[model samples]
Target chain A: MLTYPKTELNKVKRGTKRAVYDVEQINHILDAGFIGFIGCNYNGKTITLPMAYGRIDNKVYLHGSLKNRMLLALIAAKEASMTVMHLDGLVLARSGLHHSVNYRSATLFASVRKVEDPEEKKTALKCVVDHMIPDRWETLRPMNTKELNATLVLEMEIQSASAKIRDEGVVDEKSDLELPIWAGIVPLKQVAKLPVRDALLPKQLKTPKHVVTYYKKNKT
Target chain B: MLTYPKTELNKVKRGTKRAVYDVEQINHILDAGFIGFIGCNYNGKTITLPMAYGRIDNKVYLHGSLKNRMLLALIAAKEASMTVMHLDGLVLARSGLHHSVNYRSATLFASVRKVEDPEEKKTALKCVVDHMIPDRWETLRPMNTKELNATLVLEMEIQSASAKIRDEGVVDEKSDLELPIWAGIVPLKQVAKLPVRDALLPKQLKTPKHVVTYYKKNKT
Candidate 1:
């Protein structure tokens, strides 16, 4: 399907004008960032924490220690929801009420399941690592049996998702626009600095091309 | 108190070495960003959304439309938890198991209350704006009664909070350090770009000092 069939749960209620339901668009928002806020119920209170994730088609992968509380709770519940957001700019407005931020935000409701097969687990871990920095996972030393066994990998099948994007300049009251107050957008972005070699690295070992490429791509 | 007393709810479980309970350090993490991931129960599922927030002492101010579902849900529940995270870098390790990211993340649990007093509501709104761009709130046109009434302001009194900070280079197994693989840290940061003036702005008005200062501080 080109778009996700929105249920009451995934519908955007407040700013419907900015909402998007297209599967491709939602995926684009998800691919823009590797970190997402995954919500879990803890001690009768819902808490969200940032987690690194990898997406392959409609599936997202998350990994943590086998005893991680949030992952265990999500596995027990058999369902999860994750949200990813990118703050594009500050929408400085002429009036206090109109001040907003230009951002792209997507939330996904999914069916969560633990990956048991060793082969599938390996692929999932690679996906998660490559999602953060492309092409770097293959360069790392392979995971041994003990390391793989200690980690828990979860696969979330995206059931339904929606995204909201606001990428424009200020939207202020017409009357207030004529005021002498300055108004505009200050664009914001996440960037990478030069690579800092590990202190114990052999002096002859040079930085990898993949690391340099990532720096060049994300550097401001 | 110098530190928040750890409870079953706010204690860090997995990364004890990186966990921070000191109140000053938690506040520092909170002040580093203006957005937070707020978790709420919706349709029997917990969901998280990124929201802009302002902090003053122990209270966090969040403002949205009166009909916003998340805000209303928070008011009804009278409890809330918010998390803020800053991704510092990608820690590229020689081993897959040791690969991690350098970051500062904080989670806060608080009792939620709706701000009904007009003066307090105004103060809350101001706090949210100033938190985004210092000194810009007073420069904007004042909020009218209609705008104030349409907005819902919430005050969350932080009862407990914890921060985890991992800001270091790669840590690989001693056995893998001698391997010929490349390992290091690729530092990452969120930065501000040059401000774009509103399209309809009169050419005479220059960019405000507050915006300029913000850009100077945040720009790479």
Candidate 2:
């Protein structure tokens, strides 16, 4: 069982009991979501924005316009952290203080670099697209040189990471447990609805296999 | 409509066309989700974590244990930024460069302060719990003085904010429209499933009205 090195910077302090450093567990959390909150410092203020990302082994791929501010700031800092979370359920506890949401979250601290090599950049773009919907990139039009030049691709090598997950029923104090109060979990999920084909698409062109497969896999 | 005063801190740099500063729009985005990505600096490294929050007017409420690292850091800095995003769909385009997601995201810059007043602290905690599910606070067991004292609550007065929303369909190159490729949206939504009662719950106790209402409102 591989694990991320425990360091001062990446340690989870508040919920030590729920914190996990196992590499496989952290990767599972990352693979569950495509959008990640990337932390960046701008003019001495820390801000986080959700960005589309794809993870491969110890590397995470991100792409944006050449002038994207967050990407540029990360590139300048040479270090970054990304967090992904999936909300599983609402823990309705007997007491207000114990109310919490069941969730799986992972935070990765990494060394960042720009993917400037053409072949590597292309592969990274493909990874980003495929991360969103499996096998959809193969159906898309190939990228041209101009589009490639206009885009900026970044690769971050994971150095240390930690994941925290809470998936259980409500926990209430023994005294309060006997009280006449409702306590349970309300499960939540992100689902995909029916796909809407582009209006400009040819009437005869049915939805592709990859899109249908994605919908089937994601729909409840 | 009221708007947040735009400055370098809250300005949306990329995709400026989608930037929204209207206060109502930003609040609408915030109210749609309870979990927000809060960015904090620790030892010169910026890290983001997902935290449950409650919003009232220009103020956001968050509560955690006293030793929580992120909350403590935000208090030390006396300022913080939180971002909330709702992913609407995947915008699959014909070209790789045009791939995007339909989402509504808002970032808020705020001044942080501890809610030391006992009354205010109680309200903040109630707000945080009820924000997860409406009318939920009344159903929970009341908190004791000791419980109240153990919790740390922070009130962030929103100073500036901005939102970016992309709700439209795929935008592909004019030349690529003729290509025999699939381009469309797979609408995504976070929805609630039926409530799961705790195993310890008495069989005679039926699900509460508030819980049923929440499920009815959120279930697809």
TM-score of chain B, candidate 1? 0.99
Candidate 1: tens digits of C-alpha lDDT, residues A70-171: 999999999999999999999999988898999999999999999998889999999998998899888988998899999999999999999999999999
Give the Cα error of residue A160 in candidate 2, in Å: 0.5
TM-score for the A-chain in each candidate structure = 0.98, 0.98
Which DockQ value does candidate 1 get? 0.89
Q: What is the fnat of candidate 1?
A: 0.87
Candidate 1 has an lDDT of 0.93
- lDDT of each prediction vs. the true structure? 0.93, 0.93
Q: What is the lDDT of residue B189 in candidate 1?
A: 92
lDDT of 2 at B50: 95
